[model samples]
Target chain A: MKPSQRLLVLLFSGTAALRGGGFFDTLDDKTRFDSDALGLHADLSFMTDATLYVPELPAQGLLTSDDHVFFVPRLMTFFDAQMGDRLTLHTQMRADRGFDPGAVPDGDVRLDEYYLQGRILRDDDLNVRVGKFGTAFGSWAKRSLSWNNPFVTAPMAYEDVLTVSDRKLAPSGVKFAQRRDLPDNKTNWLPILWGPAYTTGLSVSDRIDWVEYAFEVKNASISSSPEVWDAAQVGFPTNPTFTGRVGLRPAPEWSLGTSVSHGTYLQDSTASLLPVGSSVNDFTQTTWGIDAGYEHGRWQIWSELIGTRFEVPWVGALEAVSGFVEAKYKITADLWTAFRWNQAAFGDVPGLDISWDRNGWRSDIAFGWRVSENIQTKLQYSLGDKSGREPEGNHLGALQLIMKF
Target chain B: MKPLPTLLLVFAGVHALIADGTIEGKLSVESMKPSPSRPGYLPSPTKQPVLKPESAPAIVYLERDDGVYPRTKTNETVRIRQSGYQFRPSMVAIQTGTKVDFPNLDEEFHNVFSCSKAKHFDLGRFRKEEASPEVLFNKPGVVKIYCEIHQHMRCFVVVLDTPWFVKTDAEGKFSLNNIPPGDYSLKIFQPSERLIQQRVTVTDGQTNTVNLTR
Candidate 1:
């Protein structure tokens, strides 16, 4: 009477005989096991969004404001388990409110990802994983999940909105702000890679035969730092960061990829913007990308291009470049329609007398509506532009609603 | 005593008309190409051409150590349906105690299941204004069918405890009427070929062909 209580009494009498069809009439053909040997899947969702900002603007400081906003940003929850046919264990968790960047609406609960995979050799085609994951890079940060995003924001090379620092007042008054020099700076809507883009240690991945690869080392660098989500109060690093990716798949509905990453994304508490004796490997941060996709039967398409640099030992090499090209179409079987366009560019940063808006672009157009296999709903509209910004051009409108269980 | 039961029913009606007999076949498929269309926004090629299993129809049967073969009492009911998301007669063969009927002419909600070691039911999700869920297969072999929330919705059913099955046309031709005078053992079942078996001999009113190339 105790093999895990006889497997919870044979899983509640086989879910009461799968509700009278007699245990799926002698079950065992698979796909309804949420737990056959210690399983427990879950992926709960609940989102709500709304944004509007057309012909309005005025707030300028802690990173621009003034337009319209609506809440319930997300309420995610994952959980996954399956500790058997080669071990596993995952976890996500979220909760939000409104404006997010380095996230601080302070309602708590964030924990993003937690890994622990394993499934090494013997034709399982390798796999290794070890703790805080996500960042196998490219193909949109592990499919920016909101039910595998077809779009609801994400992809300006995985999210953008920059600026990073600005503040002034010194001459005996003191207020300091040189974290890589900024002057009138403002525009930190943030997310050029952050949000379940988690990081923090060993990964390994495999899938030979049409190629697929991954390699990680982690513990910081995909920017938006706070140790990329509290790496135990900023500690471990004598050198870590090193991401990777390699995909291929030519046909079975095409795919193609390439990604890379490097190290030291600054932070010994910014060491006063380095060079008083320089160190953290003299400040580095590289990146690289290229992606592609194509589905079929109801269309789908994707594309990417990315690039990033940074160097900086006293402010020198700064670069950026992003790309995008989405698509989707399904128009019934529960509708869908999408389109994207993204763009970005940036470079020039010699002594930084600063006047840098350095290009930006966007263009969306969505419309989803599944309303059933666990509800969905979307509506988007965008058009942006920023080249030495001052409201150079903008108009957005979003609306989302997702529900799953 | 009533003329000895009318001479044993006129010698069982002349042994059922000299055991009928008529097998005929065709089923080729060697280099069988055709598979290149699939790039998205569909719907508009409908001059009929979407009965899957690589172009539908193919199931021939007949195997005999001679014993259990008497269940032919039809009111005919095979149906299948579920339109648009397909499954309409993706292939069927029946006769072991047939009575299929699925129906759910699509306004969504389908469920149909089948685990197929010969049989394993499941019809759950139903709806489409209800009423139409029959089953009665009585085992014999190939079941397949699916649609548990449309994972591509396929179909296959093939049953057969010998009423001498047949089902081919789409140019693969077949015909198997009243075959009961023979050495039998023919099988065929094509879905990407291979599984053919032979050995035939049905004489009495004659008509036995059986080609089946590659």
Candidate 2:
């Protein structure tokens, strides 16, 4: 038999043991291969969500609805191949094509991430990874997975859109501020920090004593689309973005962390619109964030504060602050409830006296039940509106069924 | 030609033997086949992969009808160590009010936590040391243990009110001794919390061979 077949055979030999529950019971098995020299493992999670919106939802382009209720199904899978104790190959794939912004390719299948990593220290996690990976920016990226995140949608700082554009430069602050009236025009709007910056990059991290630190250099800015994640992409710039995070765990139940990132936010399409003495590289996005978390008993709480400034083509430094606090309580072994409050505020334009973008706050509450070790279902409700906008289609109810293999 | 004291001793020994009862059996997995709850077909574009069973060892025990099993409050502690990103002896059954030690034997840190209804706890992250963290199981139910840092690491603590519980060995064989001569609810709990029960009756001086089939 081939090596792969032998590995599978070795992995399945122990499958006959009696099945047991995980923390919630019914947890998907993390199949192990006894052979220490080489092993391959995989996990697949499927989510099908149905939503009912009263007026509308921002990022209106995200999901489609015929009447008032909409439904979407997505499948996410990840594979990890361990060549040995020191080397590993990781790949993540999903079926939702347009789930990520700047996913230029039009298809049902998208490669979200693929990286090869090597361990430097035998006893420590000092390692290096090459290829596309999640940005080492904030605490959110690490918990973006469906199983890890409490809500179906990400925080507003990572999901909500602003009037500013990376593809087209606003002629004036007047026009940029007016665009907020048309929230459906998401094609030109951008989120302060894009979701889970899956850009091509190299990163290294280490944990020593009570401190943990990681740093990475990526091909594009955190706000860039997944399509341009690769250096070979048409609009990928020569200069790389830098992102880093420092975490401190002084106590077992409490943790504190801070992160920063800097990169050019505009695309090549804005090159021709540049001012007389500047290039597209002149515009950049700089951001800083602080995060804290507490885990004890049946309660877990996490909070983050993010501040960002963007160098608009003509407007120069447009500023924004965004963040959220989330708490989850395990009601029982099989049930849990979570709540998150999100708010984003934009600063006045330089000399324009007008705000750069709309200010909005949203709150989401969810209840989840683990049907079995490998299956879960969640129901969530959200309510929010933009500045002076009543019922801006932000009120929603969603139900999701999740299964793992 | 035995002395009067020897005759009395033999009669007492035979009486004691007639009073105690034993139950012995072999427990094993039904099938390694993938459960039926999974999606029948792959809606995904990736290649179809073979499905494997999720499994744990069986813990066989006897339950009295009165919901009470006469057990002494023993100070003996059962230990489950965190080592090599796994919980050693991943499955165990212990009497209620027993202490279970969660010692970190790994080179790195481990945050052992569980949300089971029987006992909820989060033993903050700790590295290997001489001191070990422990928990007392005062309630009778399944306690699922997991390492917050390592998602794959897991262990199950089957806290039982009965003292007549025995986990099957590698050969799927187990023997429970000194049971009172009475009827009981012979139950088996799988690691997944799947339960199977049967009625059993014991006679004086009898060894009951109750081999349960998958």
Candidate 3:
């Protein structure tokens, strides 16, 4: 066959293979049940962010325009029969078209998350999962598609601490889980136990699985080299990382969650000024946060209070606290409007009293319209206030179209 | 001409023996604030314009020809219309062995199913104007009705043991006649609302009233 023909055949085969796993038709229950018993899903998103750099931090990458798009199509399957009568086999495969290094020159796509899982024992009291699995930390981590999240990107605090460089869909492990109902019906009581549910932080969810307290933990080691950076200026080193989360679901429509992590970051070495050579341990970061949400009727309200504690060689201990509130109202059957406010304060050190505290306040408003059952359009505007600088803001509007069969 | 006087007397006697009992009632929101269980406070059934004070209620009529015991029931054509991909009456109460005919009056097709423990069956796809599918409800309980096509479409099928039941009108009133002057329980079912049950004694021409709010 000709080269063109061979390429066409390969493309068709890949599409068929992904489609056959049943990931594309999970939204509709009848379609999922009537056509096949398997579950399939696919999500794609594109976003452009513009930031303004203040004179104080003008040297760093600030006030820059960055546009990123990612296409992550995933396939999952479930066997009709259980593996061990108590265990059932479940697996997933993902192919990405646009997950690349953040500093890449232009549009870049790289390999993303992939893994498998199996239910060890599914009973009224105990349910165990073993194998390579995605992180299961918070509500947002499990449902990470930009199309699903209210914001285009993750929270800045999470991005700063967690290692998101490589598209780790399923952290490459073993996990066990147990859920028991308490005695009283008048009081809502449910105790749960969970862990490695079979995987580590290959995916964002794996890092936050609810093993012990509606939360999960991810531990891994990564090493990378980029051609855009100077080799002599910064030494490349492998660093081990850890991330974990815990959540509480007291009611059907209410949830509270918290996450914490401490890890090392490979960065440039500045030893000339130090008395000892290589005395500086590249970089280390620690972050922790808590959030809660309540949804009732046509209204949804959520608040997240988060903080980050960082200690670099020369930078010493830097601490930051952020609090944000968001509200969503459903105007019509398929239309909704949301408003969010965020305030963050940074401290130079843990206990020192300082004259100036780096701070930023942001307000965002968004209107979303479901044009059709499968397509949606959203328009959003954001304004930010930064300390020691003028108020800066940007407006972004997007029309997103999605279809599955 | 001579038989005219006798016929007029007979008609007057028969009219005196017949008793017409009327039933009426209203459905309203307890408050503007959305309840945790029921968020969308639908309009009060009493506020509907078509259901005026005089024509206050929507009634289903059934008559006993002999006006006595050993009742022989007749199947009443109760239409559960499907419009805008939703069931018109979110809640419905029927007697045991009563056959319910689900008719799709919408332009699009629908898939109706009941996952309730009492009855579990999926009535496959049915198109517009097609003959409705009928199911004989033999159990007494609340059976949840859902449309597979629309995730939000939901309704209830309340099956009861007794066939003697009435739905209130726009005026919030209901009357059950020919009750045989016995004591029984009155069960009311409504969508996204609470379940109401009351005990009452019925005499030949006595009238009872109940007002409910959720």
Candidate 4:
């Protein structure tokens, strides 16, 4: 960011500096119930966040001019039901960012997850989940909800624009790399790891002593968005993405985990764009990450480091590293503050100084207040700096109010 | 519903006939804090409770070293009622050996229990508007009460060794009449406040008007 923007952000987020934590309660008795004799229980919770933001419109990047000084109101609903002690069902529905065309207030609603889980062991030492589920590649997916996550926006690895595309292969490596500078590359440019990355899949996870592990076979890669998560819209487990994770909790307050995923990064639509003899499977994206967290009392510390390598038809390969370290503390029973330092750095081509994507660093700070037992309000500010770019515009100020019942 | 003080006055019939003194006082609590045993919540229950701070009552009693102090009648019974989502007065003071009746007034099931060190007991679940099995108070200390299903609902049972205890009204007024002439120790108990103790001399047929604020 430029000097003026830096000063603006510092002045904007200075009051939220004493980073802290709280796990908010966003569910009520009316929305949750238990039947002991029937061995049944269910809960339905809704979270709505209204964000007023100042978007730095990159010339040829993800944010458009329409994003400047606008309010993006979004709502998400979660449903969970359990039968007996071993079988459970879960689902998530969302309506956000104006899913409708022309940025209309009439947003389209989408179902993000509908899955069933069964604990094979009486002690839950062995468990299996089938149907649509979030990719088991990282821990970020676990805390993506408004009540669990301290920040409004996701980490850079999960939301920042990447030079790689799943819908269309870059015409040329040089041109692919150039698009990150000053061009309109909307949905065509994908994030290294999409938000939640809820893909159609089946996974088997188990907990043994202090260690937990899981493996998943999904229809699409981590970069695939909501539009291609279903089997009909994408591949049906034919050489699908493979994800696995292993976590260890040696103590009640600290957790350490690592994950790996390898998958074909191209869609069927790209079949027509490949060379005469090349197949969609020729290109792939592989990612591995490590996550760590320490939560004791009112202080919580979280960190994740991800390394990804994508092979393109023209560009032999592009590698990048993205991650973040965040901390939050509960200043009081009703108030909390948090701060995150995140960045995405791409490796330079073999001989050229240009990387596959623009390297950027960003800092997000937020303060949250509990308005009541069922409501919370968060004020957040983000400062971003893009390397080798013009019209440096990546500063945003947002206020989000969430009411759950 | 200042139930205990009214009951204490009636129960004082045996001691009022003798040469006695009276103690009346005004009490005000600066804050009504959460129960110490309240389980830690994710977003801890923000702010002080909304249990109407102005209605927080004080229980004041006198403990005397005089050997002739009257003993409470064995099996003396007292009734504390439950209505809506709360205990009728939310608190009460009673002498040891008193038999307490906890009757559910709401047309719903309610479980009365206390994990207090003074007296640990669970009255079990009662049917709609059913009378609870009598719980005899044989110990002298504060017993915090709760319902199994409704975590927010709470009540306190202050068991006293002396029968000269009375609770304050909404205006922080309380009167302890018909006390035996003697040197006594004044003790006060508030569920949300610290225990307060003071020394006093009760002269025959005299009224001691004392006031306290914290």
Candidate 5:
């Protein structure tokens, strides 16, 4: 087997024992693996039938052409060496292997995430990274890219929009964070503390500058694509983007957060006289959203409201509003069931017609059976309806088993 | 100063009670592992059970001196209420020979019983406002109480012979008040967290505090 292939097997075997609650951390006091200091993790997942629908197409554009089960196994590892009591160097490598053509070329090892993060000030809660790191955006997004969420597949809205396939995993920058204790308790005006425990400042591709805080307001500015740096001679001045976010946990059981991002996909400035080369100048897009969730006892409930406005330079703009409310209840310690209702509407724009115009609604129900701490199986069914365009939407059901370490 | 004789008489009477003393201390529950220098991985089965590491709040009473000496009275009224098909207080500890009263507060009836090594008794289904069932704890051990109808319904009955003990508060802090001044053995129990023991000496007018971590 290739080096990557051997690594994948090792990661899978290591995950088998990592299952169950973490209280097991108390079992052994001594270090188990000293020579390797090795860390391996793998997630083997399979979906019965996968489908992607595009409302714009005349026949409800469907992308599911294969019926056989598809598996996308992931392997992630890191190398660490302490460079004294205060400084340490670390490197992470992630690979995704599968038969899907959408995967990397040659059906070989693909680098999903690779980064190096070093401590700048050991006791100051400051860190610097030069390679890639996952974006610390929403709660679900940062939970864990591979095996964090409760479900096999992420929410439809989060998956379709926030997930920019090619660049989703390529978060290369540095961030600083520190956690602090607050005085507020349940009796206070705000049940939980409201303040930034720590903050981070970084510079990524395209000369973008991003600042993030634990609980305070954060802001970021970036151009459309990181590959583009100079725009003066390239016809279009770099179309700058800005984003701001505020999050709070007013109560121990409640969390409320909101974020807004506005950016323009700067079109190629230099263009030929023919309209074919330069039909539109720039496509401006702005998205603002709010999310709230509560977890009490065996029941967990959450909801989110998002609105996106797209303004075509020459063509009119289109507005889309989407929201979803979901709740999960644990019938038993190992068995759970959940239901979600989702709705979205797209405002009409002149000259440009879209199928998902007016309004759309979808519903999903899922049941999860936990085989053990590290493995679980789920079955979900979803159906949706489009108001103006198609009287009936698409219905899909999937069964997936996930093993994580 | 002339009335000093009267004040002395009152003080003597108060001191006549065996070992006049007060115990005031906080029980700080902490999580302990092999090493804090290295980060340990907590898997699913091993993951902390409760979303929050909440130590079970316990109220303990020890009877001695030919009577229910501490806590003013020995005849205790222990009511395990049934709310929303679950036990309100998951655990309860009382002195030996104490009568535990199980009152079905819910509209429906409930059957409470325990079959553990410590104690065992069956209280048939009782409706709202019905007469409560009483169980005399004969031994010092744990009594696992459960409802026949609800699988998740659970509570504990801990009987002890000692006359000195404290019940932890929501903050995981406990105090054994009015404890006799002397050398005493202390033991702390919080389900699944850790069991701790310590020896303490209480002076005539001083308090000895003990802090432990799991």
Candidate 6:
């Protein structure tokens, strides 16, 4: 056997002697890895979802012309190496497929998170994390895993589409025109905020008594499209984006917090969209939100309100406000029922006539069953309504199965 | 001759006072501030209720001096029930060589384990209808127990070589009956409180009352 394998076997033997049996005999439920061992540990989990969408009216823009059904699958793998008790390395990779409504099915694999975390002063009082990781802005980002989240989809604030394309088109193919007859002006394609939900950054966090706080600096702005950093583009912004959050525990069953992010949103290639010789900082995006959660007995509830403002040069100013409240009740030890209301309001751009920019809201209801410790199934139905769209309302049904190991 | 006989009888009676005594005490705390609660995020069920710190009981015992007391045998099985995601009798006092049976009374699965100095054992996950395995604790010290799946579930077991120990009631009252008359060190243990020790003396066939406050 290899040296590492022999070493692992010896370590397990010693642990068994100390613990009186195999490592799995005790089952360290908090972490997936064998924390007793100091070397590498691995974990894997996956989710498969089948969704059907039906439109109340003739579908337009990104939506297909008729009813559509597709399957979405995602796989996540994590590797953790503990150098010692004070320092550790963590890396997570994800493979996802079937998210784009207008494109053909394709699988995309990427490194979702990679970080090296260590203690600075004390284990609980102070710590520093460097590298790419999920944003520590709100409660949802930290608990968005398939097994952790009650619903299949993310919150509207994190997935709302911003702009479909860069240019507006008319019969003459004139770009950037705000005419109502322009085909591009009516296009519904838009970039979602999923990119900003994860970023490369350095964060300092601490927990003191009932309060916890974190402050981070990342390479790009909140909701910036094409999240991957390209150092070749205008020599990476000197002043990076800043995000922070503070949470408080007032009662054993309640938690309240607030988060904020501010930074330049325009890239070097998109800098000309603002004005001639305008610096990237001229178009800045700022977002702030308040979130609260409560769990007691057989009921759990979570709510958040987020507002984002974009400072543009010619298009006046634009603002988007979104909020959601979700609640779940356990019908039994293995069954749960949940409901959520999500809504968003966008300020009209002076010269733009995109229908997707209108106000929208959606309601979702779901029932979930835990078939076993490693398997869970959920059935959810959602209704959506938007003003100034061909399909003023839509219906969606989804069934998801999750497996963990 | 009758007076001499009576004197001999009194002398024998004075030396025959070997019966056990009773130690009664009330354990009170200065304040019972509730701990701040947080919503369950991962690995824990959202339906579980928070356990009030004041409702949990404390453990009280008389420390045994080596070679002064006989090693007691505990044949009766002490059961710690798990229901509503909380350990019933969150605090318990047990004699050395005692057998503890952990039964899952709730509908969900529960895995009970302790990493404390007194004993280290993990009763793997068991369902409500499954038979609970028993553990034998032979050492004497504090054993901190926790549910591997539920972070909020916690319990403490105080094991001692001597059989003279009792757990405080909800009203903070405890009675240790049939304790042999002697002078020994008394100890009180409560979660999140400082360990308390005092010298106590018991008289034969009398109930010694002690009020422990901190």
Interface RMSDs of the predictions, in order, are: 21.9, 17.1, 24.9, 17.7, 20.2, 21.9
Give each model's whole-structure lDDT: 0.57, 0.67, 0.40, 0.68, 0.44, 0.60
Poorest lDDT segment (10 consecutive residues) of candidate 1 chain B: B1-10
How far does residue A8 in candidate 4 sit from its true spot (Å)? 23
Which of 2 and 5 is the better model by DockQ?
Answer: 2
User: Rounded to one decimal, what is candidate 3's iRMSD?
Assistant: 24.9
Candidate 3's displacement at residue B59, Å, is 27
Quote the lDDT for A181 in model 3. 13
lDDT by residue for model 6 over B33-139, one digit each (tens)? 22211112122222333343225566667765653556564887899988767777676788888999999877556768665556867665576767888999998
Q: Runs in model 5 with CA error above 4 Å?
A: A1-65, A76-94, A97-108, A114-131, A144-146, A160-241, A266-281, A351-358, A388-393, B1-214
Clash number for candidate 6: 6
Runs of candidate 3 exceeding 4 Å displacement: A1-106, A124-139, A153-239, A267-283, A349-357, A390-399, B1-214
- DockQ class, candidate 2: incorrect
lDDT string, candidate 2, B1-214, tens digits: 0000000000101111245666777654343432311211111101112132123467878888887677764478988877645677777899998999988776555768775668877675566774776788999988877776665566778988889888766545667777777778888776545576777777776544443433
Model 5 iRMSD vs. native: 20.2
CAPRI quality of model 4: incorrect
Model 1 alpha-carbon drift over 4 Å, by segment:
A1-140, A144-148, A152-157, A165-201, A204-216, A224-237, A241-264, A267-331, A337-380, A383-392, A395-405, B1-58, B61-189, B193-204
lDDT of 6 by residue, A268-331 (tens): 6655554677676776778898999986556778998988776655564567788889998767
- Stretches of candidate 6 exceeding 4 Å from the true structure: A1-67, A98-104, A164-192, A226-236, A350-356, A391-393, B1-214
Model 6: CAPRI class:
incorrect
> Model 2 chain A, poorest ten-residue lDDT window?
A18-27
- Score residue A173 of candidate 5 by CA lDDT: 12
Where is model 2 more than 4 Å wrong at Cα? A1-34, A37-67, A100-107, A230-236, A389-391, B1-85, B95-149, B158-162, B167-176, B179-214
Tens-digit lDDT track for model 1 on B52-119? 33345668777877656766744478888877656777778888778898887665456676645577
Per prediction, fnat is 0.00, 0.04, 0.00, 0.00, 0.00, 0.00
Q: Lowest-scoring 10 consecutive residues by lDDT in candidate 3 chain B? A: B1-10
